[model samples]
Target: MRVSFLLFAGLLLAAVVSGCGGGSAASSEAASSGNTASGFTSSAAIAVTDPVTVGTLKGMSDALVVGDHIVVRSRSDAFVTLNGQPVYPGTRLSVLDKQGKLVSTTDYGFTLAAGYTGDWVMMLSPDGFIMVQSTSGTRLQHFDAQARLVGGVTDLYPTVAATSTTEYAAAENGGAVDGNGFWLATTFSLLPVTDKTQYVLKLCKFDFSGRQLTPPFMISTSALHPRVAAAGGAVLAGWLEGGGGMLAMWSKGAGAPTIRSINTGGSQPYPLVLTTDGKMGVLWNGKATMTSTGGVMGVMIDNYGTPLLATGRTDLTQETLSAHWDGNVRATVIDAHAYKGGIAIAGSAVGALKAGEPITDVLVLADYTLGTDPLSSSAQTILRFTLPGRAALGPTPVLRQMLFDDHAVLLIGDDNRLQAVYTTRNR
Candidate 1:
């Protein structure tokens, strides 16, 4: 566990952007006649956590909806709340389900720091919230849609012999839930190999009831950061190795992952959008040649990690702020949520390149087709909304992908409140 919460604590986007699923019939009616912001409703920001109080934060990823309004968020310490009040006995794993109707918990076995960022993580499951908690060991707890304790918590560290002591940004992991179950892409430290810092990159799978079902798809690589998303029965991942980018994959029942090094040719491409399927995309930074500027580069791969469209440039404008490549600014806050046939990106852009220069604080929204060029000026819709007054944009904004009735919805958090605004082309 990396104890750098002071650095990473502020990077949370607050909400995951999955197209929201079926909800309670009453709240569904309330949402129909609800207040509209950029086309979605704006809910009042409630007092969810005591930020000033120092305690361990349970879940650091976005608060994903379990059934209806059952938002499963992480607390720094072992605790759960209802209506801003501690409702569970002692400090335990907590949940809220049934369109904000209930809050319950099952006993959690991890004793962790109160101020740690995201040792405990949550994702929506068929029954309810599935929490992956890391302490000296790993525990998986299951809850029902009504926020009731489904089964007992399963400690996987002993079952799988996989350590959970690795730096993992649950958001960047691209861990997804499909029809079969959920998949998480993360790294665990192995014994020092030849006195070198070596890691075991793994994609682990669990059944709907929080049981480790099969052997994980793993590879021994030097890449420190890897992102993963499940596409039906398979998983796709992208990571950096030896100053280059590579994409690897694993079938559900496969023994090991099939890895491939992406050949960028003469183009200097920066890693970017990786879809639920294995189709990888990159934004050319125009660093290699002055004439090429910026364009979209991608390679569409098949189910077995074979290339359908080998890496090539697509017809899109190359204006994703090349400063991210030149090291003018290091910290960036951004999130993208895939829904229906398209994806919605919303966040604050990087600060000005030169200090003391006038900066424009605005919220940016980009909508695009799955394989289409979103940076293209004419092909996709890009909107930049200047914030009220000369407010600043520092940490990434909290944006969630959801659906309000039939509209493709994007919920952006402004002034600490998440507004269900920013509709996309497809529903």
Candidate 2:
């Protein structure tokens, strides 16, 4: 299938946060699309409308859109928004149906008391596991697709944090990174391990029965900004190796990461993606060129981490959109995915976005064939949507935590309301 038809079904209808049962209609429309040379039968704009209201609590945090339902973590008394408005409290951990109805609710024993004040990290796996971590940093709780409680909080943080001051502090600051389905947490030095100085980020894999499959193993990376991805197959996990400027991958039998620098040096892998063959691909955005002209390109690496294609933008003028981060403004990567015959990337143009500043006309770009050896680039300015009345994602926005397809989904909380927005196109 072409990248155009690969909308997040959850991401496609996920934007109907304020609306009701038009989703099944929309999903049927997209799925039954005609097949064309460009791989799309029809090109249409996304249908986002009819804002309604429901819920009990003040608001919810760590929101996620799974398939056709909306799930979010909240205080002991979190509110669920049916349609568009907040109804009441204790509606935390709710599942909103396609009709914008609150179908089911779950609570992880969290209360907003004096000593307990923190957010829950709610993440969904591809195999249908709703993993949740509590307000207390060390505790972990999760449920299955049927919303049944599987177990209690597992205290592995203290054991992981024993060697260093930054391993797994009990402070409710940084939580786990939900990379696909693999749950990842950062630590300095783990037990029965060496390389004591370099920072280590490890992953925990779970079985169908919600059991930890493998012990926490150290990935080759030591930096935080350069993203990591779990592309299992021959390659288990991969991350941007900071010092060497390489796209590192650790296969199943490998003792260490197989490192191959995409740009030699002076390159930051904006976001990492896994191809259909379980290989590694990334959006190569930032560079230290003379005029700084690498404008959010598509780069694909082999399963062993070899750079096959390094595609810069052909549809854009470098000077206008390709601005580098010397100190101030910078580029932001919203999302990227592998299509039928290539890779498609999207997000902010270079130097396009700033925290708390409204973007009047935001356009997301999707390059169709960016994974070929010679870089055959057929790009599309897929969708253009704007926030209502000039709204900005404030400085502390929890956007990076959510998964995005062509349509971007957002949940904004202000004045006791959880405002949801979904942006997609009909093309």
lDDT (Cα, tens digit) per residue for candidate 1, span 1-427: 0111110012112333233222111010000112221222122111011011112323223455554453534322344555796532122443433222224544332343232233444567766766664322245667666545566667554433224344432222334565667766555554322346555566677777656666666654465555555654566676656666566766656766778766443333333334554344443322322222222323334556654431363322323422111112221324555544544554444333123434554344445445432323112233333333434533434554443334333444332333333233333
What TM-score against the true fold does each predicted structure earn? 0.57, 0.57
Off by over 4 Å in 1: 1-60, 70-117, 134-137, 146-150, 159-174, 191-196, 251-256, 263-334, 351-358, 371-378, 394-397, 408-427
On a 0 to 1 TM-score scale, where does candidate 1 land against the true structure?
0.57
lDDT of 2 at 367: 35
Q: How accurate is candidate 2 locally (lDDT)?
A: 0.42
User: lDDT scores for all predictions?
Assistant: 0.41, 0.42
**Model 2, span 69-115: residue lDDT tens:** 56665545434465896434322566655444456676635332223
